[model samples]
Target chain A: MASLIPLTAPDDPRIDAYRVIKERDLVGRGGRFIVEGRTVLDVALSPRNRFTLESLLLAESRIEALAPLLAQAPADLPVYTASQAILDGITGFHIHRGLLGIGLRGAEPSMAELIASLPEEALVVVPLGITNHDNVGGIMRNAAAFGADAALFDFASCDPLYRKAIRVSVGGSLMVPFAREGSAEAILDRLAASGFTLIALSPSGASELSTLARPPRAALLLGAEGPGLAPHILARTLTTRIAMAGNFDSLNVATTSGIALHAMRRTQITPA
Target chain B: MASLIPLTAPDDPRIDAYRVIKERDLVGRGGRFIVEGRTVLDVALSPRNRFTLESLLLAESRIEALAPLLAQAPADLPVYTASQAILDGITGFHIHRGLLGIGLRGAEPSMAELIASLPEEALVVVPLGITNHDNVGGIMRNAAAFGADAALFDFASCDPLYRKAIRVSVGGSLMVPFAREGSAEAILDRLAASGFTLIALSPSGASELSTLARPPRAALLLGAEGPGLAPHILARTLTTRIAMAGNFDSLNVATTSGIALHAMRRTQITPA
Candidate 1:
């Protein structure tokens, strides 16, 4: 069992990474990201989790309930306990959920490295120009629910490891494998080289989603809500459309991913 | 054409409804709701819009770009223009989009009236215990995109007209017909009386959503993410589920609705 380390001061350098969470830029702190709340903490503390768990800072009152999960922490993991007031002062806003952790994002595999690591019948979510953290998180949640093997992000997309993104994803970001690599075309090229069918979701696609027969390995391309897939990207990839009623084809990109993934799963080809 | 009336003061009684919007309770003020941004404003200003358009408070700068849509506003509708600083002073936050309007919520139909008004062939969404505005908004968006005839919310559900909800829905809440009335059981009873097939979406459902045969008039039931449809509700309705991989079936209610609506649409039976 992991012992709790009491934190008497808000500015203790020992908990430096946990300080000023609200004002700090979300860019990883020397390759570390923050995980919030109990749900995601379970994922971070799980066996064989891809991301490295460095430490946890939690409200003291929550110790009893979280004791079970904390039992799984590594021997060297530091579990810092603080009063709710101390917790609020350390972080800029009220950490109402009161459970936080510092995690090592580690180095993501390169585009070619990611492709080489994929399983034969892998399903991947390829997001381009996704600026909103919620959209990426929702996509990861759907990816986890639909059994997507991995996700590959283009240059302009937001990091799935963003604090809010991980919280919104309900730890699906941690469960699924992902990497933010080169430009959109470069990532697509690697997927193509790996024999993956590239499906770009657009309103003016050539084939209806329900009727399309999906291949064993496929990459689903998603763009921001309004400016969808770039023209060059759409021209080369198989453009697919979800049949909608009337002129309203404006499904949120995240919701669109759920529908597309479900439809693709219907006719999913099994790998040899 | 809407004639712009310049308002120099933040506390002008004429713009009382738009005051301190951030601090105001979401409860409709004298049966009126607030609409933010130009997109939803368009829906409220339409010729046959059900909601009554009270007035508009624009940041003066936005007035020029919004001329076309403003031209369509009713002759008597007030179009008040103000400096961005004055707009911020009145609303208690930066009106970055610089467009806001007050719309009368009007009288919503009772459960029986809503049921009686359904088209011969209709697709309805029934959301229960949805406290989150984003989830409800996202569900309405999907409802509009997939041609759902109307949506019925149990008493526990939040109002779609909540400021953030309308924004999150991208104005879809204004486009779709919805009624927030009755308890879960009472609403389900009315739908059944109207010859609507009640399909409750649950992870452990009896039939896969893809394989289920939908009827001419169907009502899709959704619940909040964790405490999904109460067991009693599930026992009385035809429980259907979207197929998932492994054990993770925790799809967001809005995402679940999108997938279910898309699947039901595949074999949607039209009116006789």
Candidate 2:
């Protein structure tokens, strides 16, 4: 059985990994991401995923409740019990999820390898400047659902592996094979050379989404919520814009990706 | 000319509307929803929205930058100019967006009225238990892009007017005519009565999305991330699920909504 170390003080060295999570977010240096709450922890522990649990924090009163989940983790993963106050102090907020797990960063698939592995006729989503990790995660999750072979992030985009992103994605970020492509222009060029039907998403420009037919192998490229794709990239690719009903301007980046993927699926006559 | 109101303290009564903006998210009673950054403010000011500006907060140095936008607000809307410190104090954070607008909430469409108003051939998404207003907002934005006539939220969902949800949606929430329909079962029943194909989204069950052909007057139902549509609702509606390529269990709710709406549109196609 894995050991359950009881931490009495907020400053206990054994629980340092759980300390000041917010501050760590601010610094962008909290090695390994935090998965808070029980449901997220449950998803993280699913047999399909291969995550290494660095530690598990459980409220002393809830040890019995977490017994089944603890058993799922490998024997080496430690379970830590602490007072709610100490847990709160360490996290800088109330631990509403009542459980926490830290998962080590895992191996990332190479861009070339991921592409080479896909079926010859594939739908891929290349994300640009989508700095919000949740947005990236959601995009990947949707891409996965729609049968997209891969979800690629450009260098300017946020790390898809960020803890909250993975958790928000319900662990799909890990399940979907994603890699970081460098920039909008470079990726666009690479995609073009790759015989991809490069489609840039913009609210203001180009062919109406309803009228556009899907290409055999396509990349539905999306930009961040606001500035959208850089003008140069938009100029270089086939642009498809969703026709808004009345006054609405744009959907959230993630939502836009969902619609685009869905549209691509329809055009390709694939079940989404 | 609108008057420039200034206050130096975070506790000042003049700024009470902006107090505890973060904390007030729980009860959602007070605390002004601050839409920071210029891009968001730009969308809020579009002539087509229901929201109207009540006031503007501008840094002295930033006044010149906002002259054109400031000129667009009606003369009655208060334009408050203050030192950075005073604006920060009142706002409870640094004013990075350099522009702020206080908008008066507007009346929402009644659910019955909204339903009656839809064209016989249309795409409508009824979002349920989607307490994350941002996701709802994002969904609306996609709905608009995908040519859906409207988006309706079930009563249990979060207020579309919540600040973060609005901001995350890129102000799409305001542009889409969203009504708070209190009951999912009631609305689902009404859609069925109206001859609308009510498709409940779930991963594990129902018809594959691709097989559907030319469905007219449809409502794509979605729940929040994780819990999805309550099983009771799922049991009652026409079922359809997004097809997946890998082991990922689900898609992000907003993305799922987008893909579903797009897929449903295929069913909306008229044989040409």
The most accurate candidate by TM-score is 1
Per-residue accuracy of model 2 over A1-272 as CA lDDT, tens digit each: 56788988989887777785666552223447677666567666776554566888888878888888777776677788898888887888776557877777666567766777777688899998888877887886677666677887788887766766776666666556677867777777777777788888887657877667777778888887768888888888888886654455556677777677766776643221
DockQ of each: 0.68, 0.56
- B32-105 per-residue lDDT for model 1 (tens digits): 77787876777677743567788988988888899998998988989999998888888887774888888887
Tell me, per candidate, how large a share of the native contacts it keeps.
0.76, 0.86
Which one is best on lDDT?
1
Chain B TM-score list for all models: 0.93, 0.83
In model 2, the runs with Cα more than 4 Å from the true position are A1-16, A19-31, A85-96, A106-123, A184-197, A204-217, A265-272, B1-37, B89-96, B106-110, B113-122, B189-197, B210-216, B265-272
Estimated TM-score for each candidate: 0.94, 0.81
Q: Give per-residue CA lDDT, model 1, range A84-121, as digits (tens).
A: 88888888776647789988877877767777999988
Residues B1-272, model 2: lDDT tens digits: 45566655556665555555546642333423555557667666667556676567778878778777666666677777778877777766767567766666555568888888888776788898888766765776676656677787788988766766666666666566677767999888778887787777777656777565546777788888777888899888778777665455666677777666656654547432
Error of 1 at B39 (Å): 2.4
What are the lDDT scores of the predictions, listed in order? 0.84, 0.71
